[model samples]
Target chain A: MANDKVTLAHGAGGKVSQELMEQVILPAYGNPVLNTLHDGALVEMKGEVAFTTDSYVVQPLFFAGGNIGKLAVCGTVNDLSMTGAIPRYLSVGMIIEEGFPIKDLQTIVSTMKKMADEAGVVIATGDTKVVEKGKADGIFINTAGIGDKIPGTHISPENVKPGMKVILSGYIGDHAAAIMAGRHNINLPASVQTDCAPLNKMTKAMLEAVPDIAVMRDPTRGGVAAVLNEIAEASKCGILIDEDEIPIHAEVQGVCDMLGFDPLYLANEGKCVAFVPAESADKVLKAMRTSPYGQEARVIGEVTAEAPGTVGLRTGIGGIRVVDMPLGNIVPRIC
Target chain B: MANDKVTLAHGAGGKVSQELMEQVILPAYGNPVLNTLHDGALVEMKGEVAFTTDSYVVQPLFFAGGNIGKLAVCGTVNDLSMTGAIPRYLSVGMIIEEGFPIKDLQTIVSTMKKMADEAGVVIATGDTKVVEKGKADGIFINTAGIGDKIPGTHISPENVKPGMKVILSGYIGDHAAAIMAGRHNINLPASVQTDCAPLNKMTKAMLEAVPDIAVMRDPTRGGVAAVLNEIAEASKCGILIDEDEIPIHAEVQGVCDMLGFDPLYLANEGKCVAFVPAESADKVLKAMRTSPYGQEARVIGEVTAEAPGTVGLRTGIGGIRVVDMPLGNIVPRIC
Candidate 1:
């Protein structure tokens, strides 16, 4: 406990590692399965399941609203949520740099425990490895989640069709903007904090209300433009979005304007884009609006039969522009 | 294909990332679940499931007999196998350094595919991220595996009692020795190769033959000594092993002697130790010996009622040495 920093011994799978697990990790994320301390956890599972993996390497480990640990948990949970699965268990893998602050690691793990609890999942099993000081950044976390797939629910881009309406669950670009602001020390408005929260509950409600929702995608990484473009390519259709209808906070918008960045391509940790049949759009949107994370839900676009693999943005000034899939890297480690 | 080296753009979740997936990754690890290209994969899983995770940050990415990619797959698969589960699916998460060679990435992915196929598991889902050159080592892989837990399997340390016999799957120290030799350019014999192979099939056979195996653990990091000490502590029983009976390859022993390392404390990627009721020991050992991976399997020790929570080694000489859990970092990234 006196060791303020993580040493190579902490990850050597020896007494030091055992102490870390028993004193730090176990106490933070203790559960019956994990407490067993076997290399893996055996749990009774049934029905179809969704499986996903994601690694969080966001710079400035601590962002405005969440750290990499919280992002790691939410990202994987949201990935499973998108597949219409009731998120269940998560396995965490940490690659820590030698001499990294053990306190920071503990803080990150605490955040993971908090987020996992909020998402209604258990940290079933985990592995930790420490590399030499420069061999890795402070710490990178990989979380893989498993969830029981809901029967009668099929979520895929292939199910998207012409005349389907695209709904944005909430604001976009908040996560990327928050991370950027923290890295550059920009004094953005307090309201511009990262919108990093678990979207599974909101998503579950929407799915249950409208099982025919064609495609459900969380606009992380490449954001709305990339997601719409992927949908168009997969469904072999065109997507047209009214730029004005896309919800963007004034503060986040200001930050994007100042940085010459397109909010459409910015990453978001908590938002989702659902392509639902036109008839069910209102019902799904109403259900989304009922959730705290989806209070700003709105219909932003619709799928088209023309231009089979292109996304078009209809500007407020009556101009239409083709939005290609994001090219090159605008920002790295935004997630 | 023009870009022979990976760039930060490749992990930006944009057009370049898509090309990397479609042109390189997809072709190598394509499967029905993964081909859907959803954020996560949906699979039909039923019954008891075992889940585990491990991150491979082995230095000298490529060494004798295996590479980091192969280690990543085998490590997670073996972890699941140790729980008497038939490894079914694996999720891969890669953190790559910018400017890494695309050829090397392809090689690693291909190696993963080959290993997964050999292990009878599908690479169901994956994520890729690129960090700045100095922010990470060339590549670190985290693989999480899911397996169907055998119905009657109850492998645990607490199941160990006074009359259980410990069986080691094969020779130890080859994996750690291979990595060490590669790092220090030691002129070791060619046979000093990593014992990094998936042991799921062999384990499955053994479990089917002896349903009452007391415990199963892969002697990975910290090796046999660490594993034995842990078992002693967990079961609150004494473990007495015969040093002369322990399996050690001549070349591995020579290297360990030259390096002032204990083979008992060296890592092995593909080996496991199982505690079987004395009556079932022959049946389990026969089943293990029939598999290619377990040809060298041998009964090395037994549980004891005295000296609870301690591991005692009966040497070739008349003295008995108490083996404490490994305390310091021997080799940093032996895994």
Candidate 2:
């Protein structure tokens, strides 16, 4: 098993690499779409479509709760979900450093396959290249997904209304904390893991519960603040988020406090903020709560017309502060 | 126009980028596949298929002979052709750095669109992302391709026979020489450019003229020596290349001579090698000579029963030398 750890042969596309994919990665996440095992997946859906692409250069390929592989798939699927489409296919391209262990590659690929299968998406096509050892940090993955647009669903930031309520799908900062914890080898694990998961199913349930959701965004890179700021800028409306209303897991919050980090600025993968008419915000959140990924759904903010392009947060202490877009990298390269 | 020299904005998928693609790329080489402008092209054909993917990370996005965009398309298409397939569709992904000028991106994308069109392949799908200044050097392109296997064209190294002759599609090292020439800024009123172009049309012609061609390959990355050595190893047969019969343009030969780079290991974009029955080799060469990309086609080698897995070269001095597979990177990071 010691020999099963990272090996240069894994990047060689030879037997060692094959074992890693077939044994570790695929078994955990294999499905019909992911099983095709083709270069790029082929998807057959009948409808006008929306397409989205993303690249994951997350450092520390294997993080706390999950690895870069799962992040790549979740990020891409979430992008399509935001557009009200059912993502069906994906293209994966990996740039690996030559000396990278075959075992690590196998793990990453198997994870990708498994995640794609779970999300009902396929890894239709893939390309792999080995760069000289020093050219790349380890392995970087780039993926593009295509989804069939829902027949009549349209959700855009421009649709946010003054009376709309902002819905947080689940706990925040779990993924970021988990990754940081793993990277730094933080001791004493007490069930603190990354919340990396596919949001497509959650989006589907929310839309089915109430199809009139105004805006849906996964707070990944810049977290809740970046997404909220963008929605405000686009809708020309102000946002008021209650600090206590946002859901943060106890472990994640504890880690954030210990590290002097703001949980609001940390990344969340299996989470999203949905703006809905005040009348049906409860209905949407109720439906989200029933989904596995959104059990912690809560109302974090409300849309307002008082101050345009600004997101104001009511402090837990009855004070207020502005939530701004992230300036520099946080948890640098945390997918 | 001086303004048209090069700018990073040209590849942004925005207005100026569109302009560059429309003007330089489309105008130079426009066709049905290139016009669709999808992220990954939709290709339909009836037959078993072979697909391949490649990424171009050539430094100095624009080199002496061609740019990253051209290399991306050519590399994928060439792989498709080598497998005896009709390359019909291609997907492109570009990772461009922020602050790159609008003009440069345009030049690159336009070149890509045009070259794909000329290759008779469509640019089906594309994705673009901007990395911060230091993340990426300038621009990196990734291309994936699909093609229908040509009927009756079962070419493979496994089919090479004792009496088969090898044909060179054109002169060697022109492309590498062109890049070197451009990089050094050598003053030559009559400077030679890279032989960068689509080889599909020429490949199609060869298949039509002689469907029984045993093997076909493009000496692009590791060059002709690499390809030949691979075929020899795969087929478990010896190969004898006639140095005098190999084609080399005067300018290309001059550059290679000065640089001490052998033509056999030099990269070629618009060229290929075909191993066929001695009887069909001449006819195949004639067919190759008719296509724009194959005007310099000629027979340069033959399969032999002696010394399996070894490739020998007959020198101009009447001596024989074993041609081993390239040990190190040849044309490092070309495509």
Candidate 3:
């Protein structure tokens, strides 16, 4: 327990592991359900619920604006929120490499606790594993979340139809650019920071106001381009967007251009693209703008019957170009 | 799509990841909930439920009796079952090293699917990430399970009382011995196999007959000694175990003897120790012995009021020895 670095014995599920939980982890995430110290946590749930999982392997555990722990919590919470569910419980699984600093682990876990508290969710259960130093990266976290589905709400791509509006919440490429900057030691502008914040409150309010939204997705790894393409394919419709309507911070745009990257295909941790019926677009946008995380909400596109399952961009120069799903790893480990 | 081995692109949330899911994972785990391909799965539930998670970093991905995939599924399932819950939905999060064989991945997924089907649970949702080669071990699986708790069942250490009988489902040390055999290349008799099996059905049946079972704990990492010590500490009572009654496979005993390891402190993947009122012990034993996994069920000890917060073993030679929670990693990444 006195060791400053993690040791394999700390994950052997023995006295050392128990001590670590009691001394470090439990203090950060202790609750009635977790305090039982049973193999599993017993909880109560009613009606329908949402379940989701994500593994955060973002390199540079400490990144601009947030760390892997923060992303792990927000990513899964956002996934549940995208389904019109009230985020409730989450289980964390950590695989730490031997010799990793215990202090760093504490910092990461504290970040997760803070993020979970802000999202109105509890760390209900967890597991920890330690591998030899070289067998794993510094640390990887896998979080699975359960949320209560809102009544009278059904969010699915099947509901998308022609004349639906596509709204992008806030700027794009910030998360990707920020991670890239840290990983490659790029001197990015100070404003280029990870937009890694939980969007449950914002999305919950939007869904409450407009329960008929067709689809909701966080633009994470493959970013906005991939989400739109997926929505188009799932809804069996075409999407046409105006390039000028897309919001990209100048710093992020500069970084993307420097790396020959398209901001549309860069990841954003705290943003969502929602497909809403044309009639409800204005109301949903207004609701989104009221939230700090969605202040830059913009109606960037609309669904179309022509060219079903494809996405087209109307360039500011009056030219049309097809936007395809991201193909390869333009930016790896971007969360 | 033509790639024979996994690459970083497969974890990039781009075209490759989608192809891998569609061509490899989806077909195996495609259920109504997962087929939706939304960020999270929507499931219906009412009343109390059990939630648990475990990360499997077992070395020697494939062992004599099972592989990491089997352990991953059964470990979480058994954790939920220990709470007297009927295992239902599971979420799998896999982190794979780049260049890992696609065929191996398929084999693992297939094993998971088969185990899930046998447990009568659905692979509800999952996430996949591929780290750069060497950044991770071959692969590590994190599974979080949700189960519906049985009504009228109150299983906890606090319920343990004097005169309560302690029953163990089967032999100990098989899982740890099997992993150690593979890791150290120790030749072992063919009878030495990992006792990796799901105990949900058997447990559900047993609980039906004995609704007031005091505690149920799977003797996994740190083994029976650790579990008993924890229960004693939690309930603020003393536990006395008849060392002679503890079951150990002959081959496993040989391996442990040679390695100077105690079977009582070695892990068992599919075995559990239950505390039940003396009146229900016989009925529970009969119920457990009826199941395939619990054929070796035996009454190994009883709860006592003396020496609170400690565990004592009555040796066969008429001496008593204190058994403590494991201190260090006798075996690392065993399960």
Candidate 4:
């Protein structure tokens, strides 16, 4: 507390470490379960549960709409949500570099608390470690989460059928565009902020409306193109998407065009691609559109038995082009 | 597979990333739960669960007895064990720097699987992120675990009372001394390696023998001294330990003496400090001794009603001294 910058002692598991937990961390995310200060937290869990983990290493720390802290929480939360689980608890493990500003650390921790609260999950248990300066970046956070599975839903690629409809939750490329703008000092319109929000509520509503929805995935690092390719390969089905139906913000489109980037391959933090049965597509779309994060939800594609294990895009020019799985380093550290 | 060292593409969540998973990670830790390759793993869970998280940033990556990977798994398992739980599932999150050797990564992942198997836990889910060369050290691992609570046992500081016996599992300070020797290029005896082993089996046996064990703690990072101080403060009781009764490997003691470090304050990745009722002390000690990791288990102290919130050490020469909670950076990145 005496130093503005974190020192190695703060993670030595001694007096200083205890002080950091009591003064800095506990005040922000403290709850009955975490306040026990035991080796771990004991919580009640019943039935089947979804488990997931993600490490956030985005550069610049802060972005247009959210910081790395927000991503840390939402990423795992969305992963569980994609499994048709109601996310419940999260464990935060932070690796901080010595000499890092404590103020920034506070901001990050507070943001994590805010996002966890918004997602209706508890910050149940955590650990902190500090590496010597330069040995690590400012800070890297890993969040692992658990959620209860929705009873009647089975979310898996094997459930994908030839007549299934593929839906996009909202616009794409906003998150990656925002990160690129910050890195390159490019000015962008206000509407082009990162679309990094907790999609649990939206996905839960959709599942409640149509429990038989086959598969759901958040197109994150490799974007929609990569997600579709994986699903196609795993389910041994073909996917054909209409380029015109895909939504992209105008400023994001302009930036992607100028930078020679593909909107379909750019990362998105808060969007989901769901494969639903043809008969329930309209109902699921209506459910998604009711949430603020998924207001632009639309049917963008369909699954087919032809050319199984491949994805094709029907461009506006009336020619079909294969959308291969993204390869090489299109954009590093987008998450 | 063509690259000998990791590149940014290996973490871009695309073709290369999938290749890394299929070729490297899956071969080491693959199981039905993890093979689903969904956003998260859906696993069965029932009753109460213990959840914990830890990030391992140990330097040198490889030490005498274990590497960071082994520690990553063992550390979380031990935390769950200390909470009186049967660790069942673990999630691994890795942050690797570009240019790190693929061979080294394979070694680490394999080691994690080995440890997880030994501890009777599954690597249920995981995530990987890569940073630029200078932005991170070789690699850091964060492991979060969930374990089912052992029936009929309540391990908490609140269970501590006057006249309770404190049982310690095995010799202390080997882990820290081995790390120090590696860092300073000191030649340690072959017998003095890092004592970083999973303690779940030993703890499970002890709980089965004596379910009323008051408190359980692994003396890591801040060592036995820090654990005792915390227990004393939390339970509002005083602890008194005899210096001569504490077990310390001769070579580890020599290393500590030469380096001006106190064995009691040095870390032990495998050892545990347990507070037990006087009547159950012998049964718990016998249970610990049956396990190879806890063969040198012994009673080192007793809880007292006098001088609450303090720990005292009785010297061999007939004097007592207050053992203050460790302050400042005693040893950094020892894990």
Evaluated against the true structure, the overall lDDT of model 2 is 0.72
Each model's DockQ?
0.89, 0.12, 0.88, 0.90
Give a tens-digit lDDT track for model 1, residues B1-335.
Answer: 66998899999999999999998899999998889888898877778999999999998999999899999999999999999899999999999999999999999999999999999999999999999999998999999999998878899999999978999998989999999999999888788899999999999999999999989999988999999999999999999999988989998888888889999999999998999999999999899988899999989989999999999999999689999899856788987
Every model: Cα RMSD to truth: 0.9, 7.2, 0.9, 0.8
Here, model 2's chain A TM-score works out at 0.89
Clashing pairs in 3: none
- Per-candidate Cα lDDT values, in order, are 0.92, 0.72, 0.92, 0.94
Candidate 1 per-residue lDDT over residues A1-335, each given as its tens digit? 76988999989999999999988899999999899989999987887888999999999899888899989999999999999988999999999999998889889999999999999999999999999888898999999999998877888889988999989988889999999999989998878888988989998999899988888999888888899989998899999999999988888888889888999999999999999999998899889988899999999989999888999999999999999889967779987
Clashing pairs in 1: none
**Tens-place lDDT digits, model 3, residues B1-335:** 49989999999888899999999899888889888888999998878989999999999999989999999999999999999899999999999999999999999999999899989999999999999988998999999999999989999999999999999999899999999999999998878889999999889889988999999999998999999999999999999999899988899998888889999889899998999999999999998988999899999999999999999999999999999989966788998
- Arranged by DockQ with the best first, the candidates are 4, 1, 3, 2
Write the number of the candidate with greater lDDT, choosing between 2 and 4: 4
Question: lDDT tens string, model 3, A1-335?
Answer: 58999999999988999988998899999899988888999888887989999999998899889999999999999999999999999999999999999899999999999999999999999999999989999999999999999988888988889999999998889999899899889997777889999999999989988998888999988889999989899889999999999998888888888889999999889999999999999999989988999899999999999999999999999998999999976788887
* Higher-DockQ candidate of 2 and 4: 4
User: What's the CA RMSD of model 2 in angstroms?
Assistant: 7.2
Q: After superposition, how far is residue B142 of candidate 1 from its true place, in Å?
A: 0.3
TM-score of 2: 0.69
Worst 10 residues of 1 chain B by lDDT: B326-335
List of chain B TM-scores, one per candidate: 0.99, 0.86, 0.98, 0.99
Each candidate's number of clashing pairs is 0, 36, 0, 0
Per-residue error for B27 in candidate 1, Å, reads 1.7
Q: What would the per-residue lDDT of candidate 2 be over residues A29-110, giving only the tens digit for each residue? A: 5656445443223334454554555567665678777898999888888877877778877767776666577667777777
